[model samples]
Target: MSVLDTAFVDTELSKKTSIFGLHLWVVIGIVVGAVIVLIPSNLFASLPRAAGAAARALPEIQIDMGKVEHRVVFSDRGASSGESRATSGAETGSFGDENVIGEGGYGIVYYGMLADNTKVAIKNLLNNRGQAEKEFKVEVEAIGRVRHKNLVRLLGYCVEGAYRMLVYEYIDNGNLDHLAYLHEGLEPKVVHRDIKSSNILLDRNWHPKLSDFGLAKLLNSERSYVTTRVMGTFGYVAPEYACTGMLNEKSDIYSFGILIMEIITGRAPVDYSRPPGEVNLIDWLKMMVGNRKSEEVVDPKLPERPASKALKRVILVALRCVDPDAQKRPKMGHVIHMLESEDLLSRDERRIARDSSSSLREEPSASRLEQQTKQ
Candidate 1:
């Protein structure tokens, strides 16, 4: 494990008030170049304590007052010498127009290469007064020590005067991976308030990484939900969260359900260009299922049709996720199990399958009889 550079720790700065009152030691140094290392999740569990008893908190980011530079601290245990990382003086980040890759409400992402030739996405946060600072803190504290194959990694951050930026592993494409990791894998569950398809990023090999934590909330073990202002993409918001602003893991499941439907059918959550009956994706999907037209709901552009049973199973999962009652939704882990199971048909789906087969067998004869009567 790479130790903290003691050279950056100043005696006078350690006496100052902790940044954000988190009992963090405000230091004098900032991270320079990128250090790419796949750290074990448990590596930070045994970090040495700081000056005070409250300073024993590990896996949490420490920020300074003036030039706020945040870094992820790791423990030496379980880390091999081959995985050693080196930290240096602050390196320059480029933001030329040619490097711009993506833009969002709060920041513009510019593609940059580190001194070690590692590609990274530099999130230049729009100087929106306190909003940028709040987002920076949330992201750093949230995923600073988080190491998951499906979640984007936060390398480091820089806060100098009015300018603020976050360094992230640059993902080539975007797609959903495992919400189960956030909802069940972590100690204090993380609720991704925004789980729309767009927030999910994919690498060159199509591995997905969940991105954007500006609206993410950490729910403690004591509480099941967090009451906050309703914030998310329009149409993707869970009904309960939208109506009452009470958010929980179920809210994310609901959004994931919408995302699943969006993928199955090549349609937006709400499409004004669609006919009146098909304006809302969920409502239209329910109508299609009610008419026994579930097979027709799959996107026509798919190169080959999915197996009947497989398609039905996916639809079942999606419907369960978007259930009107949030309590009825399946947990992320359960959803993963259902999706991966070979025999995925529920009792109701079995009955539907039988009915669909009967309908298919009778269709040609019924049409023939009608034609004979007309002749």
Candidate 2:
């Protein structure tokens, strides 16, 4: 009787122990499931705070459109009372007295460095009112929304009190005017009404970028003709526009044509030394295209003769852009297409002779990679 009673007690103890183990596992599973469900929400809840903290720890970057100024913290050190005025119209000492990179009618450019060691070009406007202000506002609006690789970017601006400043990405290669005339020894003849080489800036890879919008006019307006005070580089100005104060987009096209010709022949638009025959780029190109000696007109520096056809096509497109009749001139968009298309469009075929003689060559150089990025 005692042995049977002891056996029953042992059996009952084993069953209770098994039941306890099962209950323990069920409690653990519930706890783990609850934790898993709460984790993602907890992480998300903390994200904004983490981001705010990080932003606070970083140096402040402020753009003041009123003064045309860009202010950047030079160090992790807190701002002094004087530096605090930077929030207003005060110009900080961070930029100091940097050497002038370039100067134009409207502004002086200075090379600046941020606290984070980023290089930037600071353009301080000399003429703050009248057409300059209009141009500045238009440029700000136009460049702010558009992010194209080919176009120079407007990082920020300041338009405070009497001061106006524009900040832009620093380009290492300087301007195309340097390459087209100075370094290459080509006299630029085409009237760049606003010419003087500073308008054409070069990118990191040495590709040319057209800059300085103070004088550039939008062409597609209903007025069709821009009746403004005659202004531009003497050599680059179109004859009609120069003679009659009536400017059009074709004026730019003419200037660009002169620039292209300068790039090709390594001659300035008005080279006094080019004997009697080759003084003007337009006249020279007119002779080349008329005589069908298009291949003869190319920059000797460029490699691969196959690109000559493309170059000639570009030249012809430039001419069409500068057609004596403003009504006949192609729009910038069409001009861009004419320059870009390898095969002639149905409409372009009427304007340009297909240059099939030159086979398709390697892709455009990496220097022009930005142009592709815009597309």
Best by the TM-score measure:
1
lDDT of 2: 0.46
Tens digit of per-residue lDDT, candidate 1, span 1-375: 011223332332234322111111211110000011112435345443453534322232332223333443322121111111234434333455777876765577888665556677777766435545455465455545555566677666655546666667778653332222233345466677876655666577644456765336777779989887676778889989999989998998888778767767767899999999999998887677656677798877544456555555666667767777687677776666556556535655444334433343322221222222223
Predicted candidate 1: what Cα RMSD to the true structure? 16.8
In the range 41-84, model 2's lDDT, one tens digit per residue, is 12223223332443234343554434434453322221211111
- Show model 2 residue runs off by greater than 4 Å: 1-98, 104-107, 126-129, 132-143, 160-164, 173-210, 213-234, 239-248, 288-295, 304-312, 336-375
Which residue pairs overlap in candidate 1's backbone? 32-90, 173-202, 174-202
On a 0 to 1 TM-score scale, where does candidate 2 land against the true structure? 0.52
Q: What TM-score does model 1 achieve against the real structure?
A: 0.63
What is the TM-score of each predicted model, taking all chains together? 0.63, 0.52
**Residue ranges of candidate 1 with Cα displaced over 4 Å:** 1-97, 104-107, 115-117, 124-139, 158-164, 173-183, 213-215, 344-375
